[model samples]
Target: MGIGQGSATCGSRTTCGSLDVKLRLFSSIRKYYLFSKDTAQVAFFVRYMSSQGPKEELLGLLPLSGQTRGEDIANAVQKCLEDNKIDLNKIVSIATDGARSMTGKNKGATTILQSKINHEILTFHCIIHQEALCAQTFPAEIVEVMNLVIKIVNRILSKALYHR
Candidate 1:
C-alpha cells in the first residue's frame, strides 16, 4: 500500500485479536541479486517515543529489497508507515543498513527522512553492512585461474554446500 493510514488503527487490531504489524514486500536472500544494477537495497529502523511501548512495535529487518536511490528508500519507509498507520512524530530514531544511495552526503535518505518526518530521525549504519562494505574496499587482485578453480570446485559441490 502507498503511504497513508487505513481507517482501522493498528492498536484496534490488538483488542480485536493481536498486534498485527503489516509488513512490506519481503524477499529471501538466496533469491536476491548479488550485484545487479537493476536492483537496490532499502531498509528502515524505528523506535517508539512512548516509554510505555507503542500500539505497533518497530521492526529492524537485516536485509531489505534492493532499493538503489534515496527517494526509493524514503518511499518504502513512508509506505510502510502509512500502511501500518504509524505516527511519524511518535518515531524516535532509525537505524538502517547503510547504503550510499540511502545515506549519501546530501539528499540521502537519512537527510530526506528528517525532511519528511517532523520527529527526530537518526539514521545509523548497520554494523554488518558496514563490515561488508569494509571488506569490499580493500584493493586486491584475484587470479583468473584461481577463480576458475573455485568455480570448478563449486560445480562439484552440492547446492547445500553454498551458505549463500
Candidate 2:
C-alpha cells in the first residue's frame, strides 16, 4: 500500500508521575514486529548489554488474538509488565525499529497503543538509521562489501521470501 507510514496510540494514563520515574536509558537493543496485513503476526525484540554481554529476547510475541490491534498490543504489554513483575516505574525507555507501525501518528501501532496508558515512556529508534548514516560515510570499498552481502542474502532467500 505504497508503504503507508503511521504510528499508534493507547489514549490512557498509567499511574501518576510514573513515567518520569521510569524511562531513563533506552534498551540497548532493537524491537521488531511481524505483521500480516490487518493482523499482527509476531513481535520479536532483542536487547544487548554492553558490547560483549549476552543479548536479551524481550519477547517473541504471538498475541492472544489472531487479529490484534494497537490497543490489543498495548493492553497485552501492560499485562506482560505486570506478569513479569516489571515495574513500569523503573523502565526508562524503549528501543524500537523506528518502522512506521512502531512510530506512527494516529494509525501507527505505537501511537494507538500508548495514547494515554504511558504518557511519558520514552521510545527510541534502533540504529537502523545509523546504518543509513554509515552508508553515507562509507568508502566505495566498504559499500561494495555491504552491497555484496545484501545481494547474496537476497539471492539465497528469494524463494523463501516469495513463498511467504
Candidate 3:
C-alpha cells in the first residue's frame, strides 16, 4: 500500500500505532581534528510507520567532547531515545555512515545497542555514504568541476544577504 500523506507527532507519549511499527534509527558522526582542539558530533534520526503512514524525524544532534568511541555513541543514542520516550523494542534497524566506531563487531554502537535489546535488529551502512564513497572514484576532471561548483555555492551561501 502507498504511504498516506500526513505528518506524525512525536511527543512524550506518541500516539503512533503499536502494531507493525518499524523504527529505523540513522546516525552519522562527524569528527573535527583541529590543531588546537578536537571535537565530534553525532546526529540521530528516526523513521517509522505510523497508522497514518510513514514518518521521519530528527531525534537529536549531540556533541561528544572527549572521545568518540562506540560506547559514547551508544550512550548518546540511548539518551536521545529515552528522552523521546521511544521504546527500544520498536526499533527494527540502525543505519550509520559505516565508521569503525559504529560498525565494529566487538565494541560498535550497533553491537552495544543490540546487546541491550532482547530482539534481533538489522544493522547496515547508510546508502548515501556508500554513494559518496563511490563518487570518490570519479574521474579527476569531474571532481574538479564538482569542486568548482561547490566553491561557487559556498561563496554565494557565505553572504548574509543570500540567506534571505
- Among these predicted structures, which one has the highest TM-score? 3
lDDT of 1 by residue, 35-132 (tens): 65544444344544467766444353323466457766767777677777876566556666666766776867677777877766666777888877
In model 2, the runs with Cα more than 4 Å from the true position are 1-39, 42-55, 64-68, 107-119, 129-142, 147-164
Candidates ranked, most accurate by TM-score first: 3, 1, 2
TM-score of every candidate: 0.44, 0.42, 0.62
Candidate 2 — what's its lDDT? 0.60
Clashes of each: 4, 28, 0
Query: lDDT scores for all predictions?
Result: 0.61, 0.60, 0.83
- lDDT by residue (11-63, candidate 3, tens digit) is 31344443224332111112433364456889888898899999998878877
Q: Which 10 consecutive positions of candidate 3 have the poorest summed lDDT?
A: 20-29
lDDT of 3 at 17: 46
TM-score of 2: 0.42
Which 10 successive residues of model 1 have the least lDDT summed? 18-27
Could you tell which candidate, 2 or 3, scores higher by TM-score?
Answer: 3
